[model samples]
Target: MPYIWLLPAMNKNIVLASTSTLYEGTYLDYLLPTIRELYQGVTEIIFIPYARPGGISHDDYTARATDFFATAGITVRGLHTFDNPATAIRNAAGFFTGGGNTFLLVKQLHTLQLMTALKQAVESGKPYLGTSAGSNIGGVNMQTTNDMPIVYPPSFDTMGLIPFNINPHYQDPIPGTKHMGETRETRIHEFHSQNAIPVVGLREGSWIRVKGNRITLEGALTARIFEQGKTPYELKTGAIIPF
Candidate 1:
């Protein structure tokens, strides 16, 4: 009856979210090592490099992912083939979703009917990690994502392993160029105009992680939680979110 299937803290499973562009992902060095410490360590890391959409060809995508994991000393495999997404996911000692376009990633997974499978695999007592777009899908819905809906993804069904919707790259104020982007606060407000779901604004270099009922905030500064009537509130480490 649970919308999400998360193994308790006893399993030692966790998720690391990155909402920044992968090309600018310098924080991996900081996060990956901590992921290794969770439950001591993991055997292998399976990379799900499927968020690029049509920006790049599948072969190129796969090749790029294969090479990235090579440096980590963790055996890596690309699971972009739609025919058997769940198979590859289930076999992973742990999962990492690289940053890209969350909308594209969600659409592809839904279209291929792999969203549920990805969700299942991550919650199956193994470490499931996501960066940028990869991290966005961990939440209940994809509205927090910044990617445009260029392609017709299969469904809105993302991994949904995490309860609160995640707005990766979340920032209170937009700094420089304005190409007309939606703020995390604005988007969540929009999402709430219809749905009453709680949302977490996770800035770059930060993550919201849950182990059993205890959710912890990591990385820089703090995270913000937003709901309909209430004003967005700031949270530091060790804070328990109502979501």
Candidate 2:
């Protein structure tokens, strides 16, 4: 059985991935098949590069996505290139948000007032793909992100395409090491102390795939799951997350 959203009317087409590339892999090469299926019948997509990983320019970031998608026979356009971004989103065939700094991405989206527009477009059933920081925005809020607060957004709020938050590039605790830092689990525990939203610790090579009312975990690895008050657990590949 497929996982169902707690909220109703979640009929959108979306692929919220843990990362765009795997170790020793090319950009988006690991997800080409998934991308092809998600954007079926669509020839072009608007690439949202607001996250700007490593301070890369929008044009350069978009060029990377363009090059990758071109292999799949799809055209790519940067959302920044449009005169009116909101209008561009509304008219877009689909959207692909690449990974980067969540803080910067959210700041730009809210500042430009494009958050709601992008949300509306995706909710309308346009194919949407997100990776890393890009996938973080699909959650209830950006508070669970692992990124540093390099910039401040008007709100920690995000698209909430999924009913829960996503912790992309989630890493497990190293069994033995002198390095001491808060585990991803500890930080998420801190988040749960104040917020009741569930969070999915999406591992690399895995993703949440949503089609119409069904949402399923894809790829080889198991995903860690966290709820506000319950013990953390793992859901294996193809498991329907019961939020």
Candidate 3:
């Protein structure tokens, strides 16, 4: 008789993309190749579409994922399809939360009372993926998001899956420009005035890959790290996040 052995213990696999669309192509073009390995054995993905980019319907958002994942031989199911979102999260083999308005996304999670369940799933080593607004809520709070308060959520708190906050689509100051607008850095600095948590400024084309206790920078672009009372510094690709 042959014995079936259990899989070896592995770290929690998490992908937090800065944005969904790249300048060159469709959604998740850059990460598609690498996604297969990160999501090994995951034939189904639970798609969370509460963010509703440009007010897109949940079905449309789910279809976007379905179209993309179909090529990978995976099936995508929207959380909205299930009668109980909490139960869906609890039983999900893997998860993918799309990009959109952070306020809208957070509000829906709280209203549905699935925030805790989602966090529990991620913490329990479920393969989790997030982009833009989805990545924003994976942090300590939604205070760092660039979007305005189109709608107010019951709380600014988030899943806290990661210890720090994330500011996606982070832009640097333009050279010799006269706009005189507050730069992304300045806004983050203002946020630091009240909050002591670290904030990562993830520019487009960059991302954070979390494997249990380690988070390394990925992509061609460098990410800016904003620590309380310290000057922000750039982290090169492959650099382990130093919190």
Query: What clash count goes with each model?
Result: 6, 0, 0
| Residue 29, model 2, lDDT | 91
TM-score of each: 0.83, 0.96, 0.94
lDDT for model 1, on a 0 to 1 scale? 0.69
- Give all candidates' CA lDDT scores: 0.69, 0.92, 0.89
> Can you list the residue pairs that collide in candidate 3?
none
Candidate 2 yields a Cα-based lDDT of 0.92
Q: Write the per-residue lDDT of candidate 3 for residues 1-243, one digit (tens) a residue.
A: 232221111356888989988897788878897678778999998999999999999999999999998988889999999998898898999999999999999999998888889987887788888999999988999999998789989998998878899999999998898998899999999999999999999999888898877888898899999999999999899999887
User: Residue 172 lDDT in model 2?
Assistant: 92
Error of 3 at 77 (Å): 0.6
Residues forming the 10-long window of minimal summed lDDT in candidate 2: 1-10
Model 1: per-residue Cα lDDT over 42-132, one tens digit each: 6567667778645776667666655655555666666765467777777767777777777677776777677877676666677777777
The TM-score obtained by model 3 is: 0.94
lDDT of 2 by residue, 184-232 (tens): 8999999999999999999999999988677789999999999989999
